[model samples]
Target: MKRLVAILVIILILIVLGLLSIWRLSQDMDVYVSRIDTIQQSVEQKSPDLSLIAQTRQDWENEMQLLTLFLYHSALDEMAEKWLEVELFCREGNYSAAHNTLSLLRQDWEQLYFQELPIPQNIL
Candidate 1:
């Protein structure tokens, strides 16, 4: 009876902790996604700036350290590839290609962000 109550209490605590973890991860990923959106907007301008593209890539590389802990490696790998494509397009003065790649990168970020949610469908 006391043992059963204790077990239930512990289980409740674990569930709360899990939910909190998901919330925190979602917030962090949201920030990254927002930043990507800002970069995307910048890239879509008439004359996209190469310097801004380089800076955004560097920012993403820095974030990868903490992001890798919560996100899947495959997602990260694909994001890295997209970043490379964006950089290449920017260097080649192909603003349209760079914008398209940035759009794909943003989509990936959004997908990863939602993947952190503790959805019942995901579990069952």
Candidate 2:
């Protein structure tokens, strides 16, 4: 029937839209993760640059606005806390602690990034 076909078409469109959304979000997260990796590497240097701490914070602030659209607030809150810890460590000249926090931040970002993807396991 025409009604059945119309319903199927709508459902297909919705599915496509969902997949596209996931793909776009995943790409954005990949870029953010790479930036975090760069920050981590910088923090691990012999003489870590504290300047990178401020720059990383600013980068997260800019990304958070767009990220909030597809991510949970609780996840964002946790990331913000971890980011603050990184800043604190950097300000105190604790490169080791800052490096550790950066590792945690990378893990958190990965978790959040995958959470946005439409994996079959997630759907089931």
Candidate 3:
């Protein structure tokens, strides 16, 4: 029937849109992880690069806006606080603290990335 065909079409469109959003989120998360790794390396070398952290923080703020569409606000808020600590520690020339904070931030992002995937565990 035409009604059944229309319903199927709508379902197909929804599935496509869902897959596209998941793909976009995965890409963004990958970029974020890469940036965090860069910061981690800089901090691990006992060279807290304030300039790099500042630039990354600004970019993350913009990215966070987009992330809100997919992730929970609470997850984003926790990461925001960790990011602030990393920036502050870097500015104060505290490489150890900055490294720790960066690690925590990376873990949070990883968790979010894992949670967003369309895997069997996540669906169930």
Each model's backbone clash number: 0, 0, 0
Task: Please give the CA lDDT of all the candidate structures.
Answer: 0.69, 0.71, 0.76
Question: What TM-score does candidate 2 get on C-alpha atoms?
Answer: 0.63
**Residue 109 local lDDT, model 3:** 81
Clashing pairs for predicted structure model 1, backbone only: none
Per-residue lDDT, model 2, residue 56, is 65
lDDT of prediction 1 = 0.69
Q: Per-residue lDDT for 1-124 in model 2, tens only?
A: 9999999999898767666555655566666777677777877873555676677677677666655554445767778778778888877778899889889888887777666434444432
For 4-123, candidate 3 gives per-residue lDDT tens digits of 999999989877666665666666766788889998998888776678778878777776676565444577777877888999988788889889889889888888667644533443
lDDT of 2: 0.71
Clashes of 1: 0
Worst 10 residues of 1 by lDDT: 115-124
lDDT of model 1, residue 121: 38
Query: Would you estimate the TM-scores of all the predictions?
Result: 0.61, 0.63, 0.70
Ranking, TM-score, top scorer first: 3, 2, 1
